[model samples]
Target: MSAEHLDDIGARLAAARARVAAAEHDAHRAPGSARLLLATKTVPLDGVRSALLADAAARAGDPAAPAPVLVGENRVQELVAKAPHLADLAPEVHLIGPLQSNKVNQALGVAGCVETVDSVALAERLATRCAASGRVLDVLVQVNVSGEETKHGAHPDAAVRTALDVAALDGLRLRGFMTVGARSSDPARVRAGYRLLREIRDEVRDSGEPGAEGAIELSMGMSGDLELAVAEGATIVRVGSAVFGARPL
Candidate 1:
């Protein structure tokens, strides 16, 4: 609620937007072609609101500014807690964290989209819940391009098969792929992961699998490697720390 805190968030959001804009231009993407899904994992609800307000204010003056349409959370608990109250901002709340079959109902209750769908079982669970609710949910299949054991996604080789499977589910709209780059200081390594994601997305799109028509989005990158991701044809970057400052320890 502090004015100073809100100002800090506004400034941070403005800077993040500038970086995304610059990256988009260098990548030769059309204006407003990409978006920054503020990864509001540990960020407070007020911080998210302030960032959206700042974006709205900027767009009110310049219509070309990148519109912030999504705010991502890592857990269903936080999403359910904040999504209803922040409906005014109109941003699609997404689950960017690992989703368990048991949490599908809770996640579907609040999330407009689930970006970290890593398994067929989870996808089917979501499809069932959506069917009961009479709603179709947008979902991005997560791929572990880095092959990290700790990451939650299908292996790179299995990504297309997984996406095709998920697409066939009636209640889930297959929206492309998402991945986490290797945690490394070498930019080349990170870019490789993003590149792999784009390649996979293209393969799936070309396969003409049942519901792969609109699987063009590549939800890659973060604060540390966003530019590299953009250079690799990322359509959406999940930036958090840069926009909201470091998370609380």
Candidate 2:
């Protein structure tokens, strides 16, 4: 990336972080309660590094800045392709897209977390892979709160049960829930979807089942509806276009 391009990315990243901070305040949550995860889909490796550098610079300048921004990719192939190059940065990479059963082993080799475990079968595959590798993988159950046919996640009605089952697997650690939110023009409708996710998370955490105590994260919200998500108690917001600009068509 050219110096100008890098500068633009840095500026955009700063703006995105500011938005998250403002949303957290508006929601009456602690200043840094909601974390930002950079969704790096279709972004080149250089651009990814630039964003990470920008976050590092922010932390170096302010003691209270959040830890290195988390990185998430929407494809196993992308995660496999970019992870090796980003290994030196020690980024916390997450597989945020659908995971094919055949690719579970490949995903385990790269991603530190899998945020799209939508089915018990998929979770079982991941567990078997992790056990063979002798490593426990952190994961979040993806809930289809919007009931969208296009989305891939556990149905809203079955999310809690799926989460509990995933938690029981030996090689996986349930870290709460994740959702894409409802796609709509009406803010209330969108916020309702996010709110439902929070309710499910709360229910799971209070269930007192083995391994349920640690399921506290709510990875909802994105560039467009981050504020609404924060208002609904999101613990992590995934931002992409607002930070990296629109991907090439």
List CA RMSD, all candidates: 1.3, 1.0
- Top lDDT hit: 2
Query: Candidate 1: lDDT of 133?
Result: 84
Q: Highest TM-score, which number? A: 2
What are the per-residue Cα lDDT tens digits for candidate 1 across 66-173? 666578999888988998779887887889999877788888888888999888988998898899889999999999998878888899888889999999999999
Model 2, TM vs. native: 0.98
Candidate 2 deviant stretches above 4 angstroms: none
What's the CA error at residue 235 for candidate 1, in Å? 0.9
- List model 2 lDDT by residue over 1-249, tens digit each: 667887899899999889989988888889888889999999999999999988888889787777678999998899999998988888999889999888888888888889999999999999988898789999999999998899889998999999999999998999999999888999999999999999999999999999899999999999999999999999889999998888889
Q: Per-residue error at 205 for model 1, in Å? A: 0.9
Clash count, candidate 1 = 0
